[model samples]
Target: MKRTVFIIWLLACVCTVRMDNFTYSYKDAMRCKEHICRHGYSYETFYRVDANEMRSINVDPHSVFEMHIAIQAASNGHIVLSEIPNPGVSDPVYEIVVGGGGNKFTELRRNLRRNAKSSVTTPQILSPIELRGFYIKISEDGLVEFGREGQALPLISFNDVDPLSVKYFSFAAWNGVEAKFLYDCPIPGDTSIEDIPNSHPEEPKLTPTDKLKRTLLMGRLPSVPPNPVMEVKLGFKLTSFRYNTLDSKLTTTAAVVVSWEDDSMAWNPDKFNGTTNIKLRQGQIWKPSFYVLNSDGYGAMDSTNPDTISLASSGEATLHFQTQTQNYCFDTTTTYSRWPHDVYQCLIVIEPWEAHENIKIEILDETDAKFEMFSDIDTVIHNEWQIMTEQVTLDSAMWNEIIDLINSEEVLNTHLSDKMIITVDLAKNPDLYNLVFYVPMLVVLYVTVLFGLMTAVMANVLLISNFGEALGKSSAMKQVLTCGVVRAVFCLPSMKKAANGDYSVQEDEDSSYIVDSREGVEEMERSDKEIKYGDKAELAVVVDKILFVVYLIVFVGMLAAHY
Candidate 1:
């Protein structure tokens, strides 16, 4: 009855499984490769400094921690056991090795602090067989015990070594040898032998078909047998967006989330026989393509541009890019009162090119993603709370004979969707104009126009009218008269015979009667050959000089401003 109740309670409780140890074996490699083939993979997920932070096992100064290591001899190579120090620490580093020199164990130590002491030990004896196993016990006080499991006494023991300082342990097999970690557990110092379980659970093994699928998905195999199907489940969330009036561009930031169903699915080309050729980089399999629709025009984003946002990791990534504001539906006449109903839509698609078989990729509806646009000061300007979901699946066996089609230039233009796959509705706010700055500018413009008009009228009166008469008593007007008179001799008109013109010109030397050309009329010349009209001609010359100076000044100023 107790056992039954315990089982029921266990079944009713939710369990979360978190990996805390790096128990790598051949099976682990197969699983890692399978993940790489079907989905995106990052090596940092395995060995990054932060990746194993949460997985670190706390070591008390006086506790017994047991690490079980197993090595199966390969036909050609050996296994190595390495101890990596905590990311920031550089002390108490070393390694214990096996299966390399004449089937005997070797202990390698290096980079020890000047005064640091270690008591690490190794097994002395080996069975002629290629397989070997050992359990290492670390004590709270830094004593290390090394021997085969279930042995009454450890074959080797190190006393007073600070094993607690070691951050983690990694195992690697070279050539043909296979290194496997069987178990890692902390045993109480006072616990007896009978309290521990006799055996621990092992990881599930992969079948031959699973191995083939992994290889094919990774593109490790050049080709596969008939019927290949791939399915991907994906979703995305818009984290941020905004309009930049300075650049006249709209910037959007989004987090694209992707996942896959646990079930193994495949497609047979023979059944759904159609062909569509595609080329894609393995990294691009999970990348989400963005399409923007706005007042400007419709087009795919510039994914090749440096600022064209692209971010990707194992399963998700954050994307950020700046697009033009005209790309969205906008209205210039709409004010803040009508902005509540304004909506802008953007399309997103996730597709990869040209698999020889049919594959279906679906974007799920329950993504709960929203796009929000904020002002430069982080004031909310627009929000896209609704996302329309569309799942598009394209398949055909039009596989190109060439395997490395990634080099093709046309791949850059390829989009995941021929039609809109997913649409997001963005509510745009009315354009915000700063009246404080603009109103002042408008007032300044009106004042400048009034001042310019007044200046022009005054200058025209001064330059066009009789300057000497207007300022008759001014000393400059007398100077003007004198200057005009000095040049009056050359101002005399050259003479021409009758040509039936209205104006007549008489040569100063001839003093002959000259006829005005237009009416064939003749006017008697004065007795003096060099006739000069004193004050009237002098006033005209003064006005012309003033106008030329003013015009020259205005022309040079305009040219300087233009360049």
Candidate 2:
């Protein structure tokens, strides 16, 4: 009877235990107002509850209390939610009872429209415990089930609907404990819109005036005017020019040949003239061509194409020549004489001068010899006076003799007159100029030979005087002979004894015996006495002989060199 009473008490305790679970009724809580329309439950049905309420629901201590939702697409359609699987959960357990005494579900449905545009009905209780501990699991087949019963339902379906249509839904869970949910989607491609065309236009082109202004403002200007024309004369007789060493004095005769032009297209007047009232003012200009003759008699004309030459007064004129004294050499024979063997040439120059008339030149001499004439040659007037040349021959034998005389060691007493003189005549002309002359190569050769010979003679005299003094010294001569004898007798015992040690000779009583055994005693003593006296006498003879032999050898070598 006690066991039966215990069984009855256990049954009463089990029945008295609070089955706090609740049911959600779909038919009673939710009503479909329109056919073929999308519908969903309020997303806020889930909420958080405090520890007391969680304990009341049999939740484990220290475990995160969370709300879970399960959603499945119904036949011919799919159910969409504002949150998916699990959503944000916080402390303080709140209830999600559908059709309970609170309006929390209705308020949640109103907030659902904020995230999505679709209309939603109040959630229904599908089972006896509609608000039980929510637990949801998703399988690889995209099927959702709730609780342990494993009620499988598709999260997406396309029965009697377009297959490309996508059904997107979400759910949230609220518990009295902290929990979290994450939402993710594929990153979208960039498609930012840009403004339309017609916002910009092209710029205008620049003008010539603008370019000019730019250049001027930048401090740049146009190029300068071209160079002006210069006038000169050509063709002149250059004479009376001589080089006495490097010094020069000369005179030149140029005949005035005027062929001038100005901007007016008229020939230059006889002289510089001020402009007439009707004539345009222009500068004076002249250009003259003068011919020069080469040794072969061929002539070429050169002109100052743009230069002016004018006379101070249009009358006869003459140019005077002067210069400082200088060292020089001249040969009239090589310049004026036409000897084929005379290969020397001379240069004469005429310097620039103002225009003159009637140029008269005179050649002066001790004998009063004079050659005066006018330069009638037409090819004479150009720019400044310049160098010209003439060639002549000399008597080769006479030239060689003079060179030898200058080169001799003996003093020479010759005057300038003893040399040669060349005279020139230049008649006065309207145009006269300056002149110059250059020394001929023959003269240079003469001077070079004289200098070389003087050097050689001085060297020979010095050597001979030194040699004579050396021969005169007696002691020096004695040393030479003694050295010769010593060389000849080097290996003899007498020489060895005399060089190394002293020796003495002795006479004994046996028939006046003579002891001569000391190596070179006799020879050394004899040489010592004889050398002193013989040195003076023999030195002259030796020196004379040596000199004779040296001279002979030198003579032979010189002959060979010449051959």
Best by lDDT: 1
Which residue ranges in model 2 land beyond 4 Å of their true spot?
1-288, 295-299, 303-306, 313-343, 346-541, 548-563
Predicted structure 2, TM vs. truth: 0.16
lDDT of 2 by residue, 109-222 (tens): 212223221222323322222322223222323222223112233212212111111112333322221112211111111122221111111122334433332322243221
Report the C-alpha lDDT of model 1 over 380-464, residue by residue, as the tens digit. Answer: 2335333333444333222221213645543333332322244554554323333444566567657755665666566556645
CA lDDT scores, all candidates in order: 0.39, 0.29
Model 2: per-residue Cα lDDT at residue 491: 21
Candidate 1 local distance difference test against the native: 0.39
Q: What TM-score does each of the candidates earn?
A: 0.26, 0.16
TM-score of model 1 vs. true structure? 0.26
Error (Å) of candidate 1 at residue 382 is 18
